[model samples]
Target: MMTSSIVQRVSECFIKPLHPIEDSKQISYLTGWDIAMSSMHYIQKGLLFKKPTTSPNNQQDFIESLLKKLKYSLSHALFHFYPLSGRLVTHKTQHPPSYTIFVDCSNNNPGARFIYATADVTISDILSPVDVPPIVESFFDLNKAINHDGHTMPLLSIQVTELVDGVFIGCSLNHCIGDGTSFWNFFNIWSEIFQSQSCENENDVPISRLPFHYRWFLQGYGPPISLPFKHHEEFISRYESPNFRDRFFHFTPESIVKLKAKANKEFNTTKISSFQALSAHVWRCVTRARGLTNDQKTSCKLAINNRLRLEPPLPQEYFGNTVDVVSAEMTVDELLQNNLGWAAWKVNVAVVNHDDKQVRKMLKEWLESPVVYQLGRHFDPQSITVSSSPRFNMYGNEFGMGKAMAVLSGYANKFDGNVSSYQGYEHGSIDLALTLTPNAMRALELDEQFVNIVV
Candidate 1:
């Protein structure tokens, strides 16, 4: 078992852009969907890299070198994703009541929070084969800057922690600024710069993909709707309670393939992908562990990337929130009484229903009635929200050291019935980070079907 007292913060400061934004007067307006997401908490993600053995013998010098390279690369990367260095602002006195907000891409707001820290832990402390590590949360900054008071918080914040045998990069980003896809895009680009160790010239950098900041692509068919503050309060209160426990489960390639084969055989259909099959399996196990009534309604919510689902396809580098939740609901008995293929089919259907027309309709509806419709809002003890994509090149994020030892979600422990998946370091395997009530987690641990598949 890993110890709790592991990480310690050495310094914290705001990292401004290395170069000033030339167009200080330019503003990027938030679409109705962005405005609806402004009140949500920042997404906290961490990548842990094992210490490189090639570093000089001196410990302090090695630490300094790592920080310098990281900061330099991050500042240079901000030039391409400029809006991330900006702040969210509102014009409350405007005629339409200014419920809408925009990103101020001015030179004055050209900074992101950076933190330096150390940990008395090792890669083995986190990557235990049979036990979940307690130090997972300690490897990240707990005090993330959520946009609670409008423009009070920065759009992005980063924390770098040095461990006994590894380094951890913790990133906290405002949800209104971008979704997971955009965040990973920025991460991959930053990694490219760090690995290359030269950010001097934009032309020679070889960073081919540039972010598309034009928010007009999300424009819907109707005028923006105004939601009451009470509704926001109610929505936030539902999922923010401090009554959850987070754990990670590993599924090897063999197990995943076996599950997929089983699911396909039961349905006599070969359409279910690995993700759909795994999600269905997890949803069933979680529902069974919760021990809800047979008639209780439970939903599996998945965030679908709308960038490609849109009619004309948004730019691959579009740097803003462009995702919508697609869910499939079934009663507790209906889920438990069925086979894995039954649930997998439902999950597959949910994803297939989110075509171009459905995405457009979702945007139009949100524009017409602007209310916070996050997957979190649909979550309860009986429901699960699955975020993160297994397709992201998380293991490839080599920032001058080497490949990351592990990737973790810093905030998954805070909410119940939440599941995030990442591509495991091992080929064809997946890492599932799950949060649930203490009792429910215990029940899940004792579940034979679930335990058989998990490594």
Candidate 2:
């Protein structure tokens, strides 16, 4: 076993402060995705290798050698950023960008078992999956499997099944680190590094001198983005509750297209996208399912990427939190009666137009504002909330074996949290995964339309 001191020393080598920029506004923008950025500093993608039955005794040596290789490779990555951090900080005071791989041979399944490892991949590649397992026969009870500790990196368990000589690996990762795309890219790069190593005994890890420049995002930008007080208050209120449910709902691609087509035809609107239509439909379905009246209030929060919304696109390699949560709230009556087109229009109005300088300014001021600016006094936590991060077309992720079979998002460990995602299937169908409170799903189960295909 590795000593704690050894782990601590390795971690320190990776955590270093950057050269302070002249402008805080730019710093904020650069760090807008700072939470995500900070989390990246603590990234750990573990690969579990199955030890051969005959070679079980060599596992310890393998681990030691592997650790040396990983430490060197990751330490090299940290070194490239040293100049940017003024080299004042050494690895001792900082977090390192290394992950761990454990070799488990304790299981008694001698020849029946296999091997597997997990790593990062590109942002685009991680989100989209080319294959998906058959829908579980009874998904209602699947809730027991989802767990979210809300730690910087939440661990998810995957059910492993045997495939060929090696056992297929089951995996789950926290979304806060990077979207599906970023996750895959990191994995692919790691795989490239791993596959080329002849043995874990290499004295030096190779360094990838990729670009790390980010000054372009702040060329002519000034600061102090102000966001609507009502919007800020609304989010705070909804999220304030100590308890929340995050449920996952799955829908086929054909169902989504059909829903969108119907919305388009019914509303006589051309600009509304599938997301707006589906979100609107879900909002309507759940509202009516819960028996909420038309006059009651509900809202939907869409997580928008701010990378390209600025005057110029943020760097593709810019590793940070570049997401903005945009909310669309309306009286239940308006949401229910409005044609699909109009409902979608509401989302576009709140999210797409985020490029406006005023909006950016307001957002800055709001985020920077202290807790005293919160508007929680006006609302309750029980109000309805919805969010979606689709994974159908995320860029460039491919494990050496092939594309992932499926991807799911917003899984929660609690009883009241609801999270949603749009998954792509090999059959050309889109799947919807909604995570909601058991009661909420139970309510949904009563609907014949929803019940027939829930699993």
Candidate 3:
């Protein structure tokens, strides 16, 4: 059952760029990375901030002013990340019933949707529970929105929920626009602008870095190739997540160091990374929790950043998706029979071998005869794909308020097997969030092998 309390909407409006390009209309074609992600869920993340003052009087007035300051800063931020303000435009073809996708910045009024809402809860009301409270889901603006919804919906949406003692700034951006790197780029600038306004040296704060707008594609392949499928319906299916729950497991720095040391002890070569060690551990624990047979097949899907893998590497600030996922698979008998280093080595090989040559080959195959991805399309029960990176700077996004108390996500694109990882507030720590079936969740909570290392 859903929570009884719900957020009440106060007002809504769209915030356009403060400085728009004049005379010329801008258009950008969606790259292969963008096209594939365009069919997935919007990336939803939120920052929790404690109120600045302790006064109990005129609280609503304070919140009103804070909202005004945020929107103003957002408008300025949109000037640089203008593609996010533009909506996704599609061209329809009746003969074969297909559509071509692109972002159009020519609209008279293009902007991100800003929403304000209030909830009767406190910060403790959220962080006190072992599992994420359902009310936390209400803070996000785009509840069930997917990237394909960009055709008619706002490319970016912000929902600020006023709580009794704090504020939750939830954001939703189309995955097609960019990945985590791009998201943080815009957010960091927004905070810098906001903080400068409160200081006497307002003009002293300058944007640390500007984002590059070029999209990624294969070397020989041209841009914006059409999908072999006739309609988007064939590529996407309805998502039903009525029976899943989200849980966050915090892994401390000490545990990670131990895990890494244990993994490296095997194979006699200390090459396995911390990520590989932890991923392998999680894969083994989950496989056991699910109670599969010894012969059952299991697979793990992990995304490798291709920015550095290309012949001519892309800029660090390149503001588009340069991500591609690879699978590390094995049977349950082999996986469980092996030691920590063996499984970690398997993951390492998959990541290390996905070089420029291999990536180009895969890209060529997709372009020539597009593979209709079905088995792993919708939370394939046999596979697990880690969504976000632990390297992203999540704790540094301080928007005039103090550092974030915690980082949370909204209810978008969440299925039984989807996973998202975040950098913890403490150095060398990681926070892992997962959406799993009720049975699996209970089993995981009781599994001593996994719980011994978690904080």
- Ranked by TM-score, the better of candidates 1 and 2 is 1
Models sorted by TM-score, best on top: 3, 1, 2
Best by TM-score: 3
TM-score of every model?
Answer: 0.90, 0.55, 0.94
Span of ten consecutive residues with least summed lDDT in model 3: 370-379
lDDT tens digits, residue span 337-427, model 3:
8988888889889999999888788777766765433323545775577767789888888775689999999887777667788888798
Model 3: CA > 4 A from native: 22-25, 94-98, 198-205, 371-378
* Candidate 2, residue 229: lDDT: 34
Q: Residue 349: error of model 2 in Å?
A: 2.8
lDDT of each: 0.77, 0.39, 0.80
Query: Candidate 1, which segments miss by more than 4 Å at Cα?
Result: 1-6, 54-57, 94-96, 129-135, 142-145, 148-150, 198-204, 216-239, 373-377
Taking every candidate in turn, the Cα RMSD to the unseen true structure, in Å, is 3.0, 12.4, 2.4
**Candidate 2, residues 1-455: lDDT per residue as tens digits?**
11111101111122221122233211212222322222121111222222233364564454445444443433333233222211111011113321111111111111111112322222223223322211221111112221112121122222222221222223333332233344434444434454445444444445342424332223233222222233222222222323323334566666767767877777676767777777766655665566667778777666566657776566545433455557778887887677666676777577767784744674455345422212233222223334334542421223233344444332122213233454454444444554444466567658765555333
Residue 39 alpha-carbon offset, candidate 3, angstroms: 2.4
